[model samples]
Target: MPYAPSTVNQEQSRANEGPEAVRAAVGRARDAAPAWDALGHRERGARLLRWRRVMARRMDEIVALLESEAGKVRADALVELAAAFEHLGWAARHAGPVLRRRTVRSGPLMFHQRSTVEYRPYGVVGVIGPWNYPVHTPLGSVSYALAAGNAVVLKPSEHTPGTGRWLAETFAEAVPDMPVLGVVTGDGGTGAALCGAGVDKVAFTGSPGTGARVLAACAPSLTPVLLELGGKDALVVAGDADVEAAVEAALWGGCANAGQSCAGIERVYVAEGVYERFLDRITLRAPEITGGPGGDYGRMTVPAQLDVVRRHIDDALARGARAVVGGPGSVVPPYVTGPVVLADVPEDADAVREETFGPVLVVNRVRDAEEGVARANASAYGLGGAVFARRGGVRLAREMRTGMVSVNDALAFTAVGALPFGGRGRSGFGRIHGADGLREFAAPQAVTRRRFAPPLAIQTFARGPRDLARFERLLRRRGY
Candidate 1:
C-alpha cells in the first residue's frame, strides 16, 4: 500500500489503496450496476438520501479529516462540505423527475410518429477527483451518478485518500448490501488503472496536463469522459461597479481555499474609472488575509504547488509588474502563501494567462467594461468569471465567454445547484451540476412509436420511386 501523508504534517499519513484495489472496486461496481439501476430512480434516490443522512450525521468527523488531510480551514471545509451535502440532496430530490421519460416534439415529417427521449444511467462511472476539494468535487459527480442509478468507482486524489475513504465508508454504512459507491485511493498509477478498467464513463477533475493523460488512457477503450479541469478565471470590475463590493469579493474569491479553487478569481480586470480605487483597496486589504494554522485560510494543500505560486509572482515582478501586498518572500518556507496582489502585469504573464492556484491576484487596468470583458475573454480558459457593476453587469457577464459568470459577486454560481459547472478551452469540457450534470453520466435513449400508417411508405422498401417523388414534392411544398 502507498501512503497519503498530510500536507500540514507529513508524519500523519494513511495507507492508500492500490491499483488492485481500484480493479476490485470496479468489479464490485460492475456486479452491483444491474440491480442498482433496476431499483428505478425513486428507490435509488431514496438510498442516496440515506447516504446523505449518514454524511450529515458524521459531518464533523469528515470536516476534521478534511482539515488535517487537505489543509483546509474549518470554515472553508464546512462550506465545501455543506455545498456538496446540499447538492446531494438536490440530486436525490430531483433525479426522478429530471431523468424521467418525457414526450418530445415530432416535426411535420414525423407527424404520424410519437417521439420520446429519456436518460439512462451508464452501468458504472469512474470518477478521478482532485485533492483540493476531495469531498465536494468528487461527490458532485458521485452523488449524481448514484442518483441516476449507476454504481460508482471513485479514485480520489492520492493526497486526500482519508477523505475519500470517509466518503466510501459512510456510504457503505448507509447501504451495506450493495456496493453502489466504491472507492480506490492511490497515486497516478492507480488513477490510470481506474480509467482503463472498462467503466461506463469517467468523470475527472484536475489539471489540463493530467486530463490529457486521462483522455489517452480512456481512448483505447473508447470510454467516454467528462473533465472539469481547472481555470484561470477572471474578476471584471466595471466603472459603475461598487468598488467596496468588488474589492471584498476579490479578496475572498482570490484568497479563499488558498486559491486552490478551479473557478477562483486568479486575475482582476477593472475599468479605468475605478481601476485605481479597486487597486488601492484590494492592495491594503490583501496582506490582512493571511494563510497558516488557524488563519483566514489554511496551508497550501500540495507543497509542490508552492513553487508554481512563487514562480508566477516572481515572473510578473521580473517582467515590470509591481506587487501590492506580497512578493517573492510571500511564499513561506513550508506550505503557506498569504495573499499576493500584483498590478501592471503583462497580458502574457503566467499569472494572467495560466492558473496560479494560490493566494494571489493580478489586478490590471482596462479601458472600460468593454475592454475588461475582452481582456477577460482573451485567456484560453473560460470556466468562470465575475462581473461587478451596478448597471451593465448582466450584459457584460453574458458577453464574457465563460461557462458560469457571477454578477455583482464572486463564485456565487458555485453555491447554486441549478447551475451547470464546466468550461471551454484548457478549462476542459462537460458539465457536472444541475440537469446537465445528472445527464453527463447517462445516455439519452430516444424512442419513436408509429402512431398510424404514413401517407407514403418512403421509409420501407415497399415505397416506389413515385412515393419518394411525392415525399420530395411534399417536403419542397412545405419548404422543409
Candidate 2:
C-alpha cells in the first residue's frame, strides 16, 4: 500500500490501495460496461446530472479533502472543484448531441449507398490521473467518459488517493445501480496494471516521462491511449499592453494554485519598453503573496517538487539571471516556495527550457511582441500560452505554436467548456473537456446500406468488357 505524504500529523500515514486493487476495479468496470453503455446518451446524461448535484452538495467536503490529500489551499480547492463541476455539467448536457449518429452523404461515386457515421462506447475506459488539481484533472476524463456511455476505472495519483476515492464514492450516491465509476489508488504499479487490464482505451494525465512509461505499458495489448501531459507554458507581455492587467494576469496565472497548473504560466516575455515597469509591480506584489498552510496560495503538493523548483531557480541565477522578488533561500524548509520572480533569464537556461511547475516565474525582456511570440514558440512543450496586446493580440497569439492561447487574458481557454484541451509535441496528444473529449472515449462507427441497385453493376465479377465500356462511357458522360 502507498500513502499520502502529510504536512500535518506526521506520525500517522494513510495507506492507499495496492496494484491488485486496480486490476479488480478494472474487472468490475468491464463487467458493468454493457449496462452502462445501454443507458444511451440522454439517460446517461440525466444520471450524470444527478451525480453533479451530489457533488455540488458535498463541495465543502471535497474542498477539505483537497486541503488534506493534495495540500491545496481552500481558495484553490474551490476553484478546482468548480472547474470539475463545469466539465461534468457540460459533458452531461452535451454528450447526447455530440455522440449521436449522424447522416453522411456517400457522394456521386457511391450514389447507390446510404451512409451514416455514429459513435459507440468503447465499453471500458481506463483513466490514469494526476495529483495537481486532483478533482478537476481526473474528473475531466471520468465525467466525459461516463457521459459518452463507458464504464471507467480510474487510477488516481497515490498522493491524492483519498480525494479520488471521494469522487468515486460520491458519484455512487447519484448512481447506485452499478460501479459506473471506480477508483484504484496506489503508485505507478497500480497505474501500470490499469493500462494492461484489457481496457478498450486509456486516458492518462501526467508528465511526459510518466506518460511514456504508460505508453510502453499499454503497447503489448495495443490499447488506444489518450495522453494529456505537462507543459512549460509562456506569457507574452506587449509594450502597448495594459500594464496593470498584464501584472494581474501574470500574478494570478503564474502564482495561483502554487503555479502547479500544467497549463499555467511558467515564463514571461515582456517588451523592452515596459519590462522595468512590469518587474517593479511584480517585485513588490510577490512578497505580499504568502503561502504554506495560511496564505494566498497553497504549499507544494509534492515534497520532491521542492528540489525541482530550487534547481530551476538556482540554474537561472547561475546563468546570470537576477531575482527581483525572491533570491536564494527562497525554498522554505519543508514544502514551500515561490511567487519567486527571476528577471533576465537566458532563453536556453534550464528554467526557460524545462517545466519548473512551481510558483516561480522567469521574466525576460524582448525587443517587442513579435520576439516574445517567437521566444514563446521555441519551447519543446506547447500546451498553453497567453499574449497581451492592444493592436494585434490575436495575430500574435495565432503566431505561437501552443495548442491553446489566450489574448488579453490568462489561461482563459480552460474556463470555456467547449474548447478542447490538449497540446502538441512533448505536451502530449488527445484532449479532454469538449465535444472532442466526449468522442475520445468512443469509437467511430460507419454504417453503409445499399439504397438501390446500380445500372452499371460494376462491382460484380460476372461483368464483361461490355459492362466496363458501358461504365466508362457513363463516367465520361458524368465528366469524370
Candidate 3:
C-alpha cells in the first residue's frame, strides 16, 4: 500500500502524462496566459480571493497533507499553511494597487508629454519548490505570479509532491476552466525540464547548489530565474536584551520544523555581559523542546539531511566545541535528530561556516554588540537574522548584513505581507513577498503620450538646431 494513496495516485497519473508533460503543461499555460492577462489585475485578484477561500475551507486537509508529506509537526504545519493563506490574502487584496499603472511627471524638455508605467505579466512562470515549507514557499511564488496574471507550472520537491498536487487541485476548483496553474510531479529531472520548457520565468526555492543548477539550465533558453535559496542565519543577543525572550526566539527560530527551514537560525552570538545568562536560559529551554517521530518537532523529512546534521555536530565537537545540550548521541533514527546546541565553536567549524539545515545551534560569545554585528555579518549566507536589543534594536539590526532582520522577535519579518523577503550572495536573489514580489512576476512597460504640440519638438525629424539648443538649455537648468 502507498503511504498517501491519493497523493501517490495523483503523482502516478502525472507521471503517466509522459516525458513531454512539462512542455505540454507550459503550452497549456501559454494558451491560457493571454485570456488570464486580459482579465486584468482586479479580476485576477478576485479569482485569487476565491482560491484563498477554498484553501481556507480545506485548511485541515492541507495541514494533514503537509504533515504526512513534509514530516512537519502539527503546529509547524499549521504555521506554514497559515503563512500560505496570509500570502494569498495579501496578494489578492494588494495586487490591483501594486500592479496598477502610475503616471510620472515629464521632463521639462518633454513637458508636452505625459509619462506612465504599467506592469505586465511574463505569461508563464516555472516554479520549483522545496520540501521544507512546501506549501508556503511555493505559494509565495504561485500567489504573486497568479496575481500578476501569469500562468504557473510548479514542480514540487520529490519529498513532498503530494502536497504540491493537492494545492494545484484546490486551485483548480477556483478557476476550473483555465489552465492557470499546473503541477508536474517528479524529481530534479522534472524541475530541470520545467526550466528548459520555454517558460518565460522560473522561481526556485532550494539549496544554493540546486539554484546554481537551475541557473545553468535556464541559461540555454535565457529564461529569467528568481532564486530563494539556503541560509545560515544568525541570532544576536545584546547585553541589554531580555534574556528570557531571546531564549524563546532562539529555540523556536532554531528548532522549528526540525530545523529544515532555509531561514532557520543556525548560529547565535551573545554579548559577554549576558552570555552566561543566555546560555543558562537556552540550556534550560532546549530540553523542553523535543524531536522524534512524534514530538514537539517532527522527524527530518529528507533522510540525507540527517548525515549533514551529524557531520556538522561531529566537526564542531572535534574542534573542541562543547555540546551544551545535544551532541553525537542525539541521532535517533533514519529520519529523526534531536536539537543540538554547541558553545565555543570554532569560526571555521563546519557548523558555523556551512548551512547545517538541521536542529542545531552554535552559540558563540562576543565582546559586545559591535563584535556581535561584525561576526554575524561575516558569513556568506545572509537570508535572515534577529537582533535582541532594548536600546539599539533597530540600529544593531541595520548593522547586520542580512535580507530581513527582526528587532526583538525571530522570523517576525516573514509574517509581514508588505516587507520584501529575499537575500544577497549565496542566500540567493530576487524578492518573493510584498510589492517587490508582485513586480517580480511582471515586466515594466513605459508609456509616453503627447499631451500637446511642443514649441520645441525633439523626438522626430521635425527637430532642428533650435530644438537641440532648447533641450540643452532645459538640461542645464534642471541640473541634468
**TM-scores vs. true structure, each candidate:** 0.95, 0.95, 0.96
For model 2, what is the alpha-carbon lDDT of residue 108?
79
Residue-wise C-alpha lDDT for candidate 2, range 221-327, written one tens digit per residue: 99999999989999999999998899889888888888899999989999999999999988887888877858888778898988998999889989999988876
Q: What lDDT tens digits, residue by residue, belong to model 1 across residues 237-287?
A: 989999999999998888888889999999999999999999888878777
Q: Each model's C-alpha lDDT? A: 0.88, 0.86, 0.88
lDDT of candidate 3 at residue 283, scale 0 to 100? 88
Supply the global lDDT for candidate 2. Answer: 0.86
Query: Ten residues in a row with the worst lDDT in model 1?
Result: 1-10
Roughly what TM-score does model 3 have, to 2 decimal places?
Answer: 0.96
Once fitted onto the true fold, the runs of candidate 2 whose alpha carbons sit more than 4 angstroms away are 1-20, 474-480
Considering TM-score, where higher is better, how would the candidates rank from best to worst? 3, 2, 1
Each candidate: RMSD:
3.1, 3.2, 1.8
lDDT of 3 by residue, 1-480 (tens): 223435347547346233498899999899988999999888888889899888889877877777777777889988887788888889888988988899998976678989999899998999999998988999999999999989999898888887888888888888897878988888888998888889999999999999999999999889999999999999999999999999999888999999988998889999999999999988888988888766888888888888999999999999999999989788776554567899999999999999998889999999998898898889999899999999989999998888999988899988788889999889999999899999999999999998899887777897899889988998888888
Best by TM-score: 3
Pairs clashing in candidate 3?
Answer: none
Q: What is the lDDT of candidate 1?
A: 0.88
